[model samples]
Structure formats: structure tokens, C-alpha cells
Target: MHGDRGLTVGGPPNAQSPPSAADVRAQLDILLASPAFDVPARARRFLSYVVEETLAGRGDRIKAYAVGMEVFGRDKNFDAQNDPAVRIEAGRIRRALTHYYLAAGLSDPIIIDIPKGAYVPHFAWRTEPVTDGPAATGPPPETPAASLPPMPRKRIMWLGAGLAALATVVLLVMVFLIPSRDAPVPTAQAPMPGGPTLVVMPFADLGGSPETKIYAQGLTEEVLSQLARFKELSVLGRETSRSIPPDADAARIRRDLGVRYVLEGSVRTAEHQLRVTGRLLDAETGAVLWSQAYDEDLRVRGFFAIQDDVAQKVATAIGQPYGIIARSDERRTQAGAPEDLEAYACTLRFYGYRAALGPASHAAIRTCLERAVDRYPSYATAWAMLSMLYLDEDRFGFNPRLGSPTATQRSIEAARLANRLDPENVRGLQALMGALFFTEQPVEALRVGERAVALNPNDTELLADFGARVGQAGDHRRGMALMEQALVRNPGHSGYYNGVLAQLAYLERDYERAQLLMRQVSLEKFPLYHFVSAIIYAQLGMKSEAAEARDRFLQARPAIFEQWDREMAKRNFRPEDATLLAEGARKAGFPVADTTAAETALRTAAPQR
Candidate 1:
């Protein structure tokens, strides 16, 4: 007898006759031959094995461990949780089956589905539309009793006994197939390269107040910043790690960030006392490497001391030498009490908004800096950040309300005040360098940038930014070396950092390396990435690819070509260097205006030599 939609379910007593074993085997063969199984050889083999096992009444034995060893060539000792091969293959099979049912097997009478959260296969009869055709109008003509053959009573009894036995096996197997919660957790063996990499997750705010949240964030940043200043460690940036979900597991962290360790913490405050607890976990094993608790007065100095102590302990725990990690003496003194706390909290908020990279965020950063400076006029870091904010506005052509000239002037003034207030502040030096670079003093900018890098060679972010700026100022070799070291310290840095390296490569006339480096940049987030990609592709003589890249750039930044001169000037790129980029862009099919005219205009506007 046919099941729903003419599907022949296989089993049998004489009542509703199931499809024969031979018919089910034939359907399995058809499935195996379909395009759905056209994946890698191992995956195809895996799919075939699972289906055959289920058909042979061995479905309960189809666990991940068994599949790994049987089909994927994994060793007999393979741990399903530790090695993801089995899980990965199972996911591929599920997707392949879905693709098949949606396309090639849309009208197939039988459906085979692997339910998620378990690997067991389920078979169902596919429903088909009923038609009002003449064949269904009346009952079929009856056969004469003489023409029908009768079944033997012995054969009927044997078939009934076999069906009962098969039913009992299926029921027993179903019980054994229920998933167990005590399975081992998966562990990754891929070692983190170039020393240990750590991601500091945002601190949890247990204090339940909006004001207390600021303190938690500030504490996290303080610790992260201090830890990042060690040459022996590779630390992921706060902005990158903060995006991880609070409930994410160690496996997820390893998969997403490829870090060896994760630093997590929470803060609690009551009256004037504060408690901060932190723990470091092995990303591969989910084991706590080290943990510590800090109890202090809820004052800025207390917080700084706690951060310093924790950084030192974590470094020592991770096998870093004692003397190598910089002490927080100078920084702590420079960023002292009440006023520093308030200003630093504002700066943290400013950074949060800045990471969003929108016009509104830009405006918010300006507002935050304004308040910070207003509240603490002597806070050099706040003034330095304000300077950088203006420089960023000028460089990226953001916040057009503050015209380039006004932005440059403001940047210069803020940088001067920052440096005057704190002569040893590396951030102030960086701000001064940027402002000087934009104001047509490349020589001074290079000097200041070198000073900043000298003061804190272990600061990855500073090294990367300073390297990029100084490279633009004509010290390409030195700049590249600094950037290379920065990459070594922070391997999981954002795409923008890679883009800076790509630009340096382009300047050095290494088109191949430049093209390779550009791959790390996200074209959707940075249209300039596509523009540079177009130039590199053009230089490499890939006309079709170059044209495609150019189209994408134009689609994202429609007026970039027309605004090229203004952009170059705001970035303080040398006139000759600007001309080179413009020429390459023209060659790549960009509709850039004549740079010679802009060059002559610059010459006329310059003071007599």
C-alpha cells in the first residue's frame, strides 16, 4: 500500500504493506547520486555512510565520535567535542540536504531531514497536491475471485513475526539515541602565534547605576591600556573585544578572535568602597589561568593603583619578565585624582562614540571633549584627544561645519596646550605631530612622531598611527618598521590598521604587497579601500577587476574624485605624493580633475622661497 503522496514506507505485516528493503536502498542510491552530495569527497562519504547506517537499523550508533572515526579518517581516540570535524561535516550535510529539497528534489516522494541539536535522521512522506482527475472519479473495476491468488498462511505468520521484531528494535534504539549532557567540551589545538594573545572583555557593571557604569568602563579601559603597553604580550583592542557577547563561550572566543586567553571582570561599589574581580581563561580549554580581586576606596588613585597591580600580576603569571613591563608611575601621576577621573571618564565616552564612525558620533566626540576640557582645563590627555578629534575631522573631511582651516587652527591650539600642560605625555606629542603635519610643518611632525614612538615603543596603536603619519612625511623605511612591530604586538587589529600598511606599501611602489594587504580592509566600511584597490589592480594590469573596484568606489563615494585635491591637502600629503596618487587613480579610470592645476595654485599660494 502507498503511504501519503505515494511514498512507500518500508516495513510489513500484510495490512498496510511497507516498501521492500530493495526499494528503500534504491532511493538511498538516488539521493547519494544527486548534486547535493557534490561537496568534498570526505563530506560525501560522510553523508552516504550516515544514510546507509540508518537504513540498516543502526541509527542509534551514529554518534559524532563514531562518524569522525568511521568516515573522516579521524583516529579511534577522536574526541567529538575537542575536534570540530564531525560537527562541521554534520552542518555541511544539513545545508546540502536543505539545498536538495529546495531545488533538485522538490517533488521527491520521500523527505529525509536531520533535525538540529541531534544527528539522527528522520524520514517522512512528502505531501503532494490532490487533483480532481477522472482517475479518482469512481472505484476501480473488481477482479474476479478466480483471477486472484491467495497468500499462504505460513508465509503470513512469518512476515507478521518479522515486522514485530523490527518494531521492537526501532523502539529500543530510539531510547539509546537521546543526547547526553555530560559530553566533553570541544577544545582547539591550533596554537596562537607570536606569543599569547589576550582579549579583555568589557567589565560587568554589578552596581546597577548609570554613573557606576562609567566607572566600570573606565576601569576596564585603564587595565586594558596598561596591559597593552607590554612588548611581551599581544593584546586585542578594547573596541574589537567588547563586541563579543557576554554569554559567549571559550570556543566562540577562540573561533572569533583566535586569542589564547580572555580577561573578564566585574565591578561592584557600595558607599565609598569598590571591589573589582578579574579572571583570565585559556581559550582552548576554558580553564582559568589566573584570577584576582582588588578592594580599594572609590577614588581615582585607588583605581589606578588597582589597575597597575593587576597588570603586573597578570604579566608575571603569564611568564613575562618583571622589569620589562613598564610601571604606571608617570601615567598615574599625570592622570591624578577627581578632575582626572571625570575627564578620563568623558574621554572613554568620547572613544565609544568615535568607534561608531558616523557624523553624529563625530559631533558627540566633540561635545564630550568640550565638557572634559571645561571641567578639567589642565587635563593634557583630554586636550590631546580634542586635538586628534579636530585633526580627524580635517583628515577625513568629516564635520564640514568646522571648515578645514578652522579645524586645523583649533587642532594646533589644542595640541600646544596639551604639550605645554604635560611635557612627557606621549599622547600630547602625537597630537602635536598631527597638528603640525596638517599645518604644513612635515619636518616638525616627523620629529614629534619619532619622539612619541621613542617614549612608548610598546604602544601598538601609537606605533601604527605614528608610523603612518611619519611615512607620509617621507620617512617610509622607518615608518614601515614601526608598523610591522605594531602588527606583531596586536595581530588581531582592525582592518584600518592593515589599510595603513597597504598605503605605505603603495608608496614604496610594491604593488603586489599593496594589493594583498588591501584584502584585509572592508570595502563597505571604507570606500577609500576600494579606490586604493582599483589603483593597485590597474597597476597590476587587471583591467576588468580594476574597473569593478573603481565602480564600487564611485558607488560608495560619489564625489571622491572631485574632492581629491582638498582631501590631499587636509591630509598634508606632499604635493608630489598627492600627484602620484591622482595619476594612478586616473590610470585606474577614476575621473579625478587635473592635479597640475591644483599644483600651480599651491605654488602661487605659497610664500616666496
Candidate 2:
């Protein structure tokens, strides 16, 4: 049965009762607090607002744009028509509700659901079990219950024990089909929750030769192993996924295995050249997400060389930050909706904040990370990002606890926690390095930073950031190399990369190159950006442009300019680099510092090893 406007649904003819407003609200509270939800803050708010609005009979306000504004913190400028963020969020909320009921809310009295294609949420009472239904299995209506002969007591007990044993084995294969290297794969699915999942089906050998088949198998295994390294992705191991036939299409794999993403490819090996074609698919819809072909001349490259290069390129393309998977998630989760931040989504916010270094985004991401670590205390990436945010608080003036050592201490504590959780996490090591720099332990900081980059040279963001820090620490040439490599990997990288690269150019006496790179930095009220701009313009003898740039820097960073020595120490700049920057600023008509910031920076410089 249904209530007014289909807002209330009855479970069965004899449902106890449709839940009242209080019942729904109570359920909502439980759901929001449940560990099973594991939702970011924005998602929780979306659920609460829609349910509350529907319950209050104000369902008209549940439009996507309205919810986007009131609940998701979107402003009027939000383009609801173009951005499908709200629609994507609705689907995620529905999936979360299903996950919740399947686990934590199995016996709950009321049910809350956002039906397909609508924002109006419906409430229903749990249905009663049917007592008068047909028999579950066995004899038909022709046979009476009393007419059946009874089994012997000993045999019955034995049969019961056998059934229990069979049930246990079935449960393990069907529900916990975890893959291992030496073990056989079960022809069933597992239900390990959290994040998106992937299945790399065995690649086809188009050449159909024994050698080609062996090559394909090895390539497929390598790809699977590479994908497994991305901590956020839940990947089915090779032994388990190998049982899946190379031709097992995405739709069938999804239905049989419950994986969200599928990687399918083929290998064509010839004496002249080897060609590998790969395609990523949305398992649910069988929609292709990404596809590419790699062609390598066999005469020029060995099989192992080609395999390693293709594997590295493909993994980096699909799983790296702002890569295919990241972009796909961006659609499902509005990047602007900052609220815990799943450690997956938590580290992502750093890129957005790093882009502009605005106060609002900083505060929102900070709050999100705090809530995230509270919920998932063992999450290393969340702690790592929180540490960076703390560093930004002093670097960009986002901290309210100014002049206090609390933020710095918190930054160091969080970074250390991240390292304790995952010593190999490059981002965590980066955070630790930043914290070390904050404490004037530049020697340890540089060591940590060098180790971090060495640990994961493939991580583009780390390369860019470490480049900037090293440049500041008097290694402009080495820093320039790292930043350039990062820019190649991430073409759509943040403006900060260009900003740092520009400073390095200035240090190298390439004022023309510095000015060219400087023009690329957006005017977002970033004090350091304009400060460098002023120096570059003055060097080029553009007097009026230099004056304007100096004014912008002064207006945005009056405090930093006044306490120049402290800022220098905070930045961890090497003495030589600090001196060069100060000289440029002096030539740009900026006020001279009360004392030489270079001497202050000298105290923190790492000695030659």
C-alpha cells in the first residue's frame, strides 16, 4: 500500500504500521552514526536533509539544485543544469542505504529509500514474515505432513551435521572468495565493502601461439600486480581473476563477481612488432571508460622492456592522481562538497586547496579530515593530509591559533602518526618532512623528502612539491629537473607547479623564462605568486607592472612581509636561495626586512653530508 503522493509505502498487507516522523528521524540518526555508512560529511548531510524535508511535508524543496545549495554548501553560481553532481550523489546515497540495511539495519523497524529518478525519499515499515506461504522446498500439496515417514534418530543427526559442514564451505567460497598466489580461485563473488573494486580478466592472445599466450598471461599478471599497489582500489588477485576467461565480458563478470570496474585487453605479438590494446569498462553498464593501444617495434625493444614500460604507463594513466579513476570518482562525488573524508577522498582535497590556497577550502578540508581520522583512526593518508593542512595554516595564514605552537605540534603529531601507520606511504613521508621543516630540522626534513621521492618516483604531486622545497633549500638545478618531470606526468597540474618552476628560473638568472612561467600563475590572491611576479617584472624593467605586482603581494601578505625573517625560517629556505629572493624583492621597491631573512634561513639549512 502507498500513502499520499507515494511518500509512504507499506511493506505488506499486514505491516505493523507506516513509520512516523520520529521513527524515521531516529533511523536516520542511527544510520548517519553507523560505521557501515562510512560516508563523507556531505553525503550524511544529503541523506538527513532529504529525509527531514520529506517528513516535514516540504518535499518540494528536495530538488537537486535546492539540496545542492542548502545541504552541499553550493552557492547560487552553481550550474545545476550542467553539473550532474547532485544526481550522482543521490545514487551513492541509495547504494549506501542498501549497504546499511544489508549489514547494520537488517532488523530495523523502518526503511528509508530514495527511489530511482526522484529526490523524494519514501518511508516504509518493515514487513512481517509470511507464515501462510507455500513450503520452502520438498513435497507438493498432494502429500500431507503427517503421511511422511520419520527418519531414524541417528541418521537424522548425521544428516544435520553433514548439511552444516556443507553450508560452511559454501559460505566461504561464495562470501569470502579472497584470492592468493598459490591457491585456486573460487567461481563465486566476495562482498568486501569499501571503495571501488576491479577485476583484470586474462588478456587474449590474438596471435594464438604458445609463446604469445605465455606473454599475454605474464602481462595480465603484471598489470594486476601494478593495480594492486594503489591502496584505495580493491583488486581481485591474479589467481582468483585468472579463472575468469579472457572473453568473459564486463556485464557477465559484474553479474557473477560483483566487481565495479573491469580491465580487458588483448596481446598481438609478431616477429616485426608487438601491439597491446587495453580497455577499461564500467562493469555495471558495460560502458567503456578508457581505451588505448601500445605499439612497440620488437627489433628496437626487448619483450621485458616493452612489458615494463606499458605496465608502468597504463598503471599511472589509470590510477594516478587526476587520472582515469580519479576523474570518474570526481563525477560521482562533487569535488567541491568537502565534508571525513574517506582517506581516498581526503588526500584529494589537498590538490584543490593547493590550487588556490583559499581560506574557505582550507577550513572545509580541515574539518573534513578531522572528522575522517575520528571515524577511521588508523587511516594513514587522512593523517598525512591533515598534517599538510596544518603546515598550510602557518604558510598561508589559515590558522586561527596564530603565534601559538599548537598547530605546528599538531602537524608534527599527525605526520608521525601517518608514518607509524604506513612507513612506505610517500604522502605520509612528505607530511613528515614538512613538519620537520616547520621545526627547523631541515637536515632530517631533506633526508625524509629525498627518501620519499626515491620511494615513489611515479607520484607526480610528490615530485612537484619536493621540487619546490628543494628549490627553496638551494638546489634549483635538481629541483628544476623534478618539477619538469612532474609537469610531464601531470599536464593539468596545479598553478603552484608553474609558480615554483618560475622561482627556480629566477634563481638561474633566466629572467625571461621566469617571466614567461610567472604569467601562467592565476591571480587568486596568492601572496607568494604576486610577490614573485613583482620581482620578475622589476628585473625586466617593467616599472609600473612591478609596482602593481608589489602592491598586490603587500595587500595579500602584509603580515608575512613585515615579519620577513620568521616567514623565511617557516619556509625553510636555504641561505643562498633566501638571499637571492630578498635581493629581487628589494629591487622591486618592496620595503627592506628589519633583518636579513637569509641569516635566519641559514640556521635551518642542512649541512653537506
Per-residue lDDT over 1-609 for candidate 2, one digit per residue giving the tens place of the 0 to 100 score: 222222222212233345556556666765664555655567778888888888889998788889889987899998887989898778778866775776667756567899987889988755542323555686556757656643332233235445545754674454233332211222321112245668888888899445788778878977877776665566776765867865677877765555678888899977767889998898888888999999988789888888877876777677666667767765655654333325456556666676678878888888877766655655667778888888777777885555544677768877876786568877799899988887788789889999987766667767788887787777889989889888877777746778888989998889999999988877674556898888988888998999999998888777776777777777777677677778788889888674595755555664632
Model 1 lDDT tens row, 1-609: 222223223312232333334444444555654433324446667766877788788999999988888897788778898888787667756755765676656655456777877776776545432322344456545867645543332233335445545744553354234322211111211111123457888888998455568777877887776666543355776766678898998878876556667888888878777777878777878877567787777565665576665554443333221122111211332365333244445555454443335456667767767775654444566778788888766666567543334677777777776776567677788789888987778788888988877766555656777888877776677778778866765554556667777887887889899988999877656665788888888888989989999998787567766767776765667665776777778889999876554476557768865
Model 1 TM = 0.44
Q: How many clashes (backbone N, Cα, C below 3 Å) per candidate? A: 1, 0
The reply for model 2, stretches above 4 Å from the true place, is: 1-193, 208-210, 335-346, 402-405, 525-527, 594-609
Which consecutive 10 residues in model 2 have the weakest lDDT in total? 182-191
Model 1 spans with C-alpha error above 4 angstroms: 1-345, 349-358, 402-405, 555-560, 569-576, 595-609
Best by TM-score: 2
Best by lDDT: 2
TM-score of each: 0.44, 0.65
State the C-alpha lDDT per candidate.
0.64, 0.72
